[model samples]
Target: MAWIMLLVAGLFEVVWAYSMKQSAGFTRLLPTLVTIVGMVISFVLLSAAMRSIPLGTAYTIWTGIGAVGAFLVGVAVLGEQVNTMRVIAAVLIVSGLVLMKLSAE
Candidate 1:
């Protein structure tokens, strides 16, 4: 359950990140609102998950998910570059996430 919350929190992190970009430096209204709301929800869930998961593990996973998720979103939605180096970096981040999860168990 804590893990589920954490995953959801991570996803929400992605939501807020994307919306934040869409917000255009907080100039846009709707996307700005979405960013704020998503940030609140994401923080709440992350706090809840932290009650059970260790702080280090929870934070690392949360950030890792957000980083990778945002990277993918950038590539897919924003049409950002997807070079070999970037791909390798993402893979390394994912590998680290897996290792972190394994260590926590």
Candidate 2:
């Protein structure tokens, strides 16, 4: 349950990040509202997940998911560049996330 909440929170983190970008520095109303709502939900779920998951592990995983997810979204949806170095960096982040999860066990 906690992991599920954490995953959802991480996803929300991505949503907020993308929405923030779409918000045009908060000038846009709808995207800004979506960003605000997404951030609140993400933080709430992260707080709940923290009750069970270790702080370092949860934070690392949360940020990792957000980072990689945002990268993918930027590439796929926003037509951002996808270079070898960036791909490798994302892979390293995912590897670290796996290591962090393993260490938590």
Per-residue C-alpha lDDT of model 1 across residues 68-98, encoded as one tens digit per residue: 9999999999999999999999999999999
Name the 10 consecutive residues with the lowest summed lDDT in model 2: 1-10
Model 2 Cα lDDT, one tens digit per residue, 1-105? 998999999999999999999999999999999999999999999999999999999999999999999999999999999999999999999999999999989
TM-score (C-alpha, index-matched) for candidate 1: 0.99
Cα-based lDDT for every prediction: 0.98, 0.97
Candidate 1 has which clashing residue pairs, if any?
none
**Candidate 1: worst-modelled 10 consecutive residues by lDDT:** 96-105
lDDT of 2: 0.97
Give candidate 1 regions above 4 Å deviation: none
